[model samples]
Target: MASVAFGYLPILLFLLVALGLSTAFVVLPMIVSRFTGAHQPNPEKLSEYECGFPAFEDSRAQFDVRFYLVAILFIVFDLEAAFLFPWAVSLDSTGWAGWTGMMVFLAELGLGLAYAWKKGALEWE
Candidate 1:
């Protein structure tokens, strides 16, 4: 109804104000920096900042796939733990159905881990 739509007016106004403030923050800095920022381009300033370490080699270096494999595995296990939190919280209300479902989920994760292990996904070298 008309009254229901009117109820959302405050939220709409708040959204507009939030958008305006965000735009002001982004634009104000750009404007200020454009006018007052210095334009010095010396060799030291242009050089890469590598924790006070001078450039020893090219920056375009290839990383090992072992790092990516470990990272992906960590994310998969991390998400499994994240899903377990809410399931544990409502375990009493969900009864046996919830317990069985969680068991199946864990079994699936175990299988995946086993598969990865068999494929040498967990190996560092």
Candidate 2:
């Protein structure tokens, strides 16, 4: 039991250091800014920054379906690109199975892209 607890000492030390650093990073800046008076709030600074003007619609306004579609498509492709790097790195160890699996994944993404293009989801108008 002592050895088991000893094995976790490094992890506990790491967590302590991480907590200390994170707390210092967050609290030190506020303390420095407070003393320097660099974070003074103003009406202009507090106002909305979007569109460089006051918002015309409610903040909870509904967006078009195309907006969501585009966002989802971007996230899907972005994750697919992220997966490629790890798959490529492990390809030698994984051999033919990895290669074929990635090929299939790419093909599926290509087909989805084609389907979306055919449905005019890629069009801005």
Candidate 3:
């Protein structure tokens, strides 16, 4: 058991060194920047501006529903594609099980798209 434990000593040492180096890399820059950087503050420095337009607006202003609909659709499709990556990588080994699983997943995504379309979520007018 002692020999087995000794065999892993190098790996344990490497992990500790790696962790220490990573921490130092992150901390050193932060410490240096804090000491050397300018500590200046002004009202205009914090204001948000885009193309010379005032960026802030009334907090209670109503937003167009289409914007939210498009965002939701984007998230749904993006997640669906995210799942496809792992399935694609193991395609050769997964055989029919993977194919059927992906088919089901695609079918569900298609249903969601269809629902969104029928509900006028896709219409921009």
List, residue by residue over 37-124, the lDDT tens digit for candidate 3.
7434577876666567575679788899899989989999999999999999999999999999999999999999999999999999
The residue pairs that clash in candidate 1, if any, are none
Q: Report lDDT per candidate.
A: 0.92, 0.96, 0.91
What is candidate 2's CA lDDT for residue 25?
Answer: 100
Residues 38-82, candidate 1: write the lDDT tens digits: 544679887778677777777778778888889999999999999
- For model 2, residues 104-123, the per-residue Cα lDDT tens digits are 99999999999999999999
| Poorest 10 consecutive residues by lDDT, candidate 3 | 38-47
- Each prediction's TM-score versus the true structure: 0.60, 0.69, 0.60
Task: Return whichever of 1 and 3 wins on lDDT.
Answer: 1
Model 1 CA lDDT for position 93: 100
Report each candidate's C-alpha RMSD, comma-separated, in the order given: 5.6, 4.1, 6.0
lDDT of 3 at 104: 95
User: Which pairs clash inside model 2?
Assistant: none
Q: Show where candidate 2 strays beyond 4 Å.
A: 1-32, 47-53
For model 2, how big is the CA root-mean-square deviation? 4.1
